[model samples]
Target: MLLKSPWSPRLAGVEGTLCDRLVASLSEDILSGTLSGGDRLPAHRELAWSLGIGTGSVTKAYAVLERQGLIRGIKGRGTFVSVGSARRDALIDLSTNTLPLMLTDKLLSRTLSAISRRIDSDHVNLHPPAVGHDEHRRLLARWLGRQCVEACPEQLILTGSGQQALWLAFDILCGGRGIIVTERIGYSGALALARHRGHPLCAIGMDVEGMCPEDLDRELRDHDSNGRRRLVYVTPTVQNPTTRTMGAARRQAIVDICRRHATPIVEDGVYTLGNDPSLPPLVHLWPEGVFHVSSLSKSLSNGLRLGVLLAPPQGIAQARSALEAIPMTSSPVDYALLEEWVSNGVADSLRDSLRGEALRRNNLARDILKDRPLLTDDSAFHLWWPMPHARAEALAASALERGVSVTAPNAVRTDPEDDESGIRLCLGGPSRAEVERGLSVLAQLTSDG
Candidate 1:
């Protein structure tokens, strides 16, 4: 006996190919509560027959939805809607890992006004240089210098964001032909980029110091034995989710391992601005072998959409040329605004203010979950609560039911089978009151253990 599925997607007027349109319709329904969490979905063949679409399209749509964390499938029980699927506006929304909006209307208006008055015909008419203008790079280099990163403007390639910089580094360094090594738990953006590019990835185990140098050496040695190319990507300072910062010795050791293996590194320093910058980044240790990436989104304002890729002397031309080939979304106006902010000390002011706000949120979380263990520091925008994978997912579902959103475990863990799962609570996206409320909910839930 065949039972009809309760949910059916309306694809009329939805734009895209068959598969894309199907995905869009289903996503809209799921997010809008037309289709709900835990509702059983029709099997591919069943849905295809009902919708008059090919089974392949249905399969593809399901894959897309699953990737977006909107749906899930159990081998025998069949596919079902994911409980994590909810309209973002209805929740406290702690999943987004970005600095909260601290920019006042007055400051932004002043900055834009200043930029508009300075816009010249030549600046507005001409296309930006492939690697950004010298003045823009110079200001960015000066900003990096303040953070203890020594680099010249010539070696810097301006990017739209930290994610784009990572994309460029992975594309050029690996060329989708080699292995990408990173920590077991890493930034979701980088991991997704590697997977999307079809670059083979391996995760190194970590200790209290962050990426284990000994494990990295062995992995590189094994891969090198096969004449394979490998690139190491790491986030040593305030590592994503875990919020672990490596010391000077640990950084040197990891750098030494990669240098010994003759493998290049793409170091992510986006979070370094908010942390203690006394410890030098890996690029400073081995500038010729590391591609350092940083951006102003975390510190100043995400609206700026400005980032820089500090390449080695030998790789400067190649990185620049590669970036030039891709169509850039940033405009001359954006660069001018960044340049103005950096020059007038507005950038530093915003960062200091955001840092204070983040610290306050962190303290609140600490007070609420004082007895519970956390993988967080006072400087980071997010905190991690480690638990079993099943428990983590359960906690997320529980929090969602209470109207407090959190990052799903699948977004953070590299292996689904790994027992150690973590739930990342982003404190920077929501207001201080909302963050406190969310933390209290989590505290109550965890206390029920």
Candidate 2:
């Protein structure tokens, strides 16, 4: 909801006081939560037409709002409200891939303590099925179905982590030797695995919205459809390295392309924090060919090492068989704990808290790096900036020297020849003050050198 009502900005009195009235209306809406933290307001021209007031009023109101930290104007992008400041910690680290602890840690500790006391007598089956054929699969499926995916037990294969799920997806979908196409800038771990196994990665082009469907179609066409095409991997939501999310239409287009080509798609939701019912996973669109891999690592605790791979019945069975050989299977204790969390709504509660924290963190990042055009999604724990490859390296080094750590473009680039630079600033690890300090250093370096 951008604005509750058109011409809702209270217009009282004559031309001279229009700006003041407009500001009051906006302020009231913001305080009432009708206009949320990241909600974009109507453009000045459009609002003027609706309210029959001068555009100057809107502009003036925006200026005053910006100074008060109530709102901010992103160039080219619209104006959004500020969620206020973040809490500060000791050292600032922008390189972490993990999230801040929400309620999961406290819940986990309490659960573990209870489990330890009960572990004495009858808890013999400490090793659950690594393939997740039992309770874990059923519970997880029901929990995940909340995302509008509607997964079944037969279609879910449990793994130690999302990376493990990816490994299984690659083996089942690609047979270890075809072609694995992914976004040009993607998850470094997956890219590293592709390189290690000698899989020729066809890096597709991406923009702020995410992997371009036209570019993906082009890349798919160039390769021998029957011989080379294996799996097309993507992090559609909260995409790594660049915090870009594909809109519903873009995802549909990509799904249509893959479905037509008979290509198996690996959909990574490793870092996706939101379970927005509107943007369902690609697997929901085409369960037969789309393999959705997600984990509790981002939303819950990383140390739990609990991840699930959902595909069609046949596809998940094939992947599940490969899981038998992997040493890092979910322990029965942890599996049972995860099952309890899902069944009792603990996971959902924790996820909700994490989502709120992420929003707060994103707001902090926006306020800190607002001057530079940084890529960010509202619920993401990270921010990205596009720069020259060389400049990215220099800035990262400078940031590190100044006690702020960051990951630059080369780390996530799929091509060795790619010289385009970018930086991924993680906002989840540090406190508000620490992140502000780190961002200040990076911003100064970027602006100066």
By TM-score, the best candidate is 1
In order, the Cα lDDT scores of the candidates are 0.79, 0.72
For residues 1-449, write the lDDT of model 2, one tens digit per residue: 34433325555321114564565556545655565677677788888888998899789877756664667888877777766511122335677667775554577788777667654233344554557646668867876776566787877888888888888888887776768988988787788677656678888888877899999898777767466547899998889878888889988999999988888899998765665678868887888888898887776765778888887777756665676676445666766677667667787777787788888878877776677878887777877888878777667555644555565455678876787658888887776677778888876776643
Candidate 2 matches the true fold with a TM-score of: 0.74
**Clashing residue pairs, backbone N/CA/C < 3 A, model 1:** none
* Candidate 1 C-alpha lDDT tens digits along 1-449: 54456786556332125665576567656766777788888999988888899999899879867866888998978898898785543456677688889878998899889988886557568777878877778878988888778889999888888889888888778786668888888777777677768877788898887899999999987655354477999998999878888999999999999999889999999986555666889998998999999987876777878878999878877776786789443667777777787779887777788778878888899899888788887778988887888888678767755667677676665554567777888898888888888888898988865
Clashing pairs in 2: 87-432, 88-432, 88-433, 389-421
Model 1 scores a C-alpha lDDT of 0.79
Candidates in order, TM-scores: namely 0.83, 0.74
RMSD (CA, Å), each prediction: 5.8, 19.4
lDDT of 1 at 363: 87
